[model samples]
Target: MSGPRKGKPVQPGQTVVVIGGGISGLATAALLAAEGHKVTIVEKQDVLGGRAYTFSEDGFRFDAGPSWYLMPEVIDHYFRLLGTSAEEQLDLVKLDPGYRLISEGASEPVDVPAGRQRVVQLFERLEPGAGARLEKYLDSAAETYTMAKRRFLYPTFQSFAPLLTADVLTRLPRLARLLLEPLHSYARRYVKNPSLQQVLEYPAVFLGASPFTAPSMYHLMSHLDLDVGVYYPMGGFARLVEALEKQARDAGGTIRTNVEVLEIETAPVTSRRRPAAVRGVRVRNGGGSVESLPADVVVSAADLHHSETALLPRNLQTYPERYWQRRTAGPSALLLYLGVRGVLPQLEHHTLLFTADWEENFKAIFGKDTFIPSPASMYVCRPSATDPDVAPEGHENVFVLVPIPPDPGLGGSGDERLERAADAVIGQLSEWAGIPDLAERIVVRRLYGPADFERDYHSWKGTSLGPAHTLKQSAFFRAGNVSRKVEGLYYAGASTIPGIGIPMCLISAELVVKRLRGDTSTGPLPVPLRAAGVAEGTVPKGTTA
Candidate 1:
């Protein structure tokens, strides 16, 4: 029933049911509940965090998803909006030299520092006078990050109209120059050394695309990583999720874990403009009577395609299958979580192991849409190196991630393939970390792949970050925050605009909430998010916009 006309301020007591208790759902529930709306978060998993869940085994704690934590401001902003600080709530520590990267054959390692100047210095060491070039590259990337955040990331554009607006139209040429080029081209121009180029473009590998194909706009990630700094929450990443759950509860939002939403209820109305205005949700329990929860709004933070095609009443669907298929989705990642018996020597908080034949590796994964027998690059995170509490005094906790193609045809026998890949990476890491017989030292180990991601979080094509951040997938080109064909339904997380990583996902939630509530109390743009060309910028109430 279309109970009320559009644009009128309805009373805040209307029930809002958020399906999926991931970062996005919890965030939406928290913001809405804070605004006096009654909210319920229905999650399939037993825990609150979706892919970002945590597990404890054999005296070791592992952050199941999102091993690396970048962009502290996003987390801090969420707290500030709730009248608190991340430091006060979660003991966040700034990790120096954010991560380490090593070429499989090379004996030396490349360290990506936390600060811009330090990063530039490291670049110089890679190549003569590369530091100056790095500064210039970061400057440009920072500019792009600032412009996109203001003009694209925060705004809710149902279609291309907002992007083609008068303001954006006038700046088309400049914006294109900033975001349209390929990342590889941009990096090659600045850093001449192959090693330096590899380091600069490493972040794109996580998107499941090679730097040569990924849009240069993603280069903005470098600025986020270098300038803003990387941080780790004390205890573990699961603690961050726990803190968020607490905030949601404090704001009066109800979160139910181990509850799976089977279907969405909708009623046809002549006045309706979008596909469906949700009436409620039907959920299934372990073994009990089915529950039908009524709500005025149902936000599906679950799989975008799953919510539309499988969960929703098919007869009431708006968009066809072709539409979703055409939208460029990002790649899915295969991950390995292991607890070693002995502390890994010389291992930092974060490390990247790169293969010499990176192009070939990417071709095997992306071009062929299959798992490469030898992955081009892999990221290893040893949280124990930074947080002593993560592992036993003499032991270490390690999480390894290798970005691979999401196609099932390519990834044969997921778990078995992951073991083989993990073994390869462990072999290389053992050599790099100067450890003898690393596999034998393993005390605890677990393997996860695209299938697991698909099952656990309902990720489409088992993608970890939504879709690849290509030229066509950037900004307005990516999925919109609000569904075009569905009213009272919004999308958040990596697949949507401003794309991937924990920080951007968090920001996506904030952007969607701000758009829905029409709350505009944020402050002036923080230096980091301000456009380089803008003479003046205003920040929204909750955001250093």
Candidate 2:
């Protein structure tokens, strides 16, 4: 299953099986199929978009996962890779007041508006000298973002040689400090006010980490949020998933729903030195009978732990159980989906409610002695504040996410433990956000917890994303995208290289395509032969370190 010679225009049309129909899987299928491969995506659920799945009931449509759409250039680059553009597929709305911060003990909530200057001004108004410092911080972050997109993000880290290049060697001292220092400490270097510090540190949670543990290199995230701006694709994340599905189908990719992969069938090893080769995937069809789909190559976009530990034979499991045991998983969430009666004017399209005891709250989620916190920091998305089509005429679509310890035993929907956790958050939100009638106004309620994530996504430790981006688990230290133990077997999605989030997952798909092309360069893959414009800062091949 070795790829053709380098720089050769190889023949295509090899049958490729993509496990999991998530963003990475669908996007991988689109690229591969468009390249003349016969690509087929098999999804376990009745629909696609693994975590980005949507559901509707009683006139309310809800995006069950991934509400915030940050990193537009990544999406734009992906759209162009499909020979299309974001402007053509769906309407994207740039959020105003970027997001509302409801902080503990504060009389007024801080509304972070669109644009970098406004944020600087807002910080200036909050604390003297913080505005200028923040500007300096974002400037540094923007430079780091450029460096990462150019030399880090898209490449498959097959060796540490790429990290040893002269350019990287010259910046080793600075890069090491960024990678070793905690994000909280790094943010404090720029901002003095606690609230302003929180704004820069909060993105660690989305990376499945606490500011105390996450690498300061992730300050690059601030550029995406405060500089690139937060956006909401008008119809929700599922709509973006649908658009990717359309792209895959338009490129001749076959999509099959209600298909559970039973086993990743691999050819028996000819030598201990030569790993087992991919044969195909044995899957169970919707009617509960088994079927075999042969493939020259297989990409597992399912949870990496699930794919390696459960699907492959022990010999072929590159990341075994012991490997996962050493990893720190991102926090599992206690999610509340409520269709409340009437609108909540106080809530913005995106609301972040932080507990005053910020460090303690994170300790509750990620500490050695973990437990769900009463005054847990939480995020609320009231889609109705922006998109009217999500809910009935007057009702609001409210989704609450509370980061909790990733304990599968903490229980599931309708359980006492889960309900108690929800109660704690609801009570806190009512007081902190001044939404006095928050509880009683709920006309519809749905609860999801760590156990639900385990059951639905086979998430390791029920983590909402993948492993934490702690200093040890970032960059070259993070899990690789390809399987060294199995020829023609690859892993995608949040669990592998490049880490979590929708945009990263899309890039993970591209990385797999790059691997198949025998393109070992450590940089972003060249924009495919299409004339669609490239995203800002995307590095062309041969120009990277």
Candidate 3:
């Protein structure tokens, strides 16, 4: 046939099929549909949201994945892009004392306040003169955050020329410092206390990298968390998903659930350099028969490795199987969804139970061998503490997550090792919370491990998060959003640019759409009111970044 059109905006009524109905996929479909393109999403699951799916049993409801809601501004920005606001669609509450951190050997938990001043005070209490140091650290982090948003995160870099911009060149020294230093090393430069170090480095784990290995540039997460603030949707994350789904459907995008994409169909390109151009997708319908759907463009928001290796032809695959095997993956979580009959007075909405040997824990999870470490650090989310609708009266909805190495050996029918691991987690949690009969009070329990992620999401190595954000796998180093061999075939989600997390996935969708529409503008940078001289270095009262 003909060669795929290049450097052309997707015309109105042009067919676009998006594979995978996850947040990124849905967001991409919505944006394209809003531009008058005929967009359709094919999802394997019975519902939308993919990992962010919600499920209920009896009177309890649980957000299957991504419990923490950081970066409220990102969510708000996304909603605004779609001609609506998060406030108009979803009921959002700003959480004070964002989370509780209980370090090993500490008798009392440290409440991470939403207010920056209170956070400074918390640091001062932990270490003498730490308050001022924290201010300096946050100031540096804020600068990085500003530069990242303006020059990095939203941009679709076709080559190294984008990195040589005047604005970026002016900040070369600062950028170099951030890229060269490890997050742990940078944090240690500010605070001496171990607890404080953990507090600063904790956000790195969410990005699927240990602070020791992750670049200091990621410390911008501190600005996002401390200055920007944490938020919660009234119902849960699922509510946000529902809102996006509505946004997509309202924009004329079609969602087909219970349909699995078998392969991305491509035709030979006239250009000798380019092998093929996307035709559409071959999908196994709900009836169990495979059929092809025609589209001018195809976007696969599913697992990057799976899409390349399984769906695309072997010759067209960008990364080899060996490349994926050598690449470091983010941690796989041992998840426990528990419905407790009574209230947990000691627990906050979000709590981090840390181990005494933090170094060993990281080594065990990301080291050569894959297994659960002893005295593991765990994150617990109790949504019922804030939203009572998630559980029955006097009951609590809790999700306990323990990050472990993505051990391919784990999971399957009759896996006693998985059961033993669950037992260990429960016992540790009970002891840490000082709840004697915590296990007995559980009226409902569901265990999810690596196998579940592999089976359900087709995740490479069952990683809950995507690839680790190491220096070699970040920004331009990460998988590209556009395909090289196949024209009009694009990719999004955690596996591609801007990396992982909910907000990044949303941005990934926007970036892909920008590429498809040939929109070259990087968009406006989000400057806080204080930076604009509307306020003085503080988030306005009752407002989030």
- Clashing residue pairs for model 3: none
Give the top-scoring candidate (lDDT): 2
Q: Distance from true position, residue 43, model 2, in Å?
A: 0.7
Q: How do the residues 288-384 of candidate 3 rate in per-residue lDDT, one tens digit apiece?
A: 9999999999999999989999998888877769779778999988888899989897788998998878778999999877578867899999988
Model 1: lowest-lDDT 10 consecutive positions:
523-532
RMSD of each: 5.4, 4.5, 5.9
**Residue 95 miss distance in model 2 (angstroms):** 0.8
User: Which one wins by TM-score: 1 or 3?
Assistant: 3
Comparing 1 and 2 on lDDT, the stronger one: 2
The true-structure Cα RMSD of candidate 1 reads 5.4
The reply for model 1, stretches above 4 Å from the true place, is 1-11, 159-171, 206-208, 408-414, 518-545
Question: TM-score order of candidates, best first?
Answer: 2, 3, 1
Candidate 1, residue 318: how far the Cα is off, in Å: 4.3
RMSD (Cα, Å) of candidate 2? 4.5
- Candidate 3's displacement at residue 163, Å, is 3.6
Clash totals for all candidate models: 13, 0, 0
- List the global CA lDDT of all models: 0.71, 0.85, 0.84
Q: Top model by TM-score, which number?
A: 2
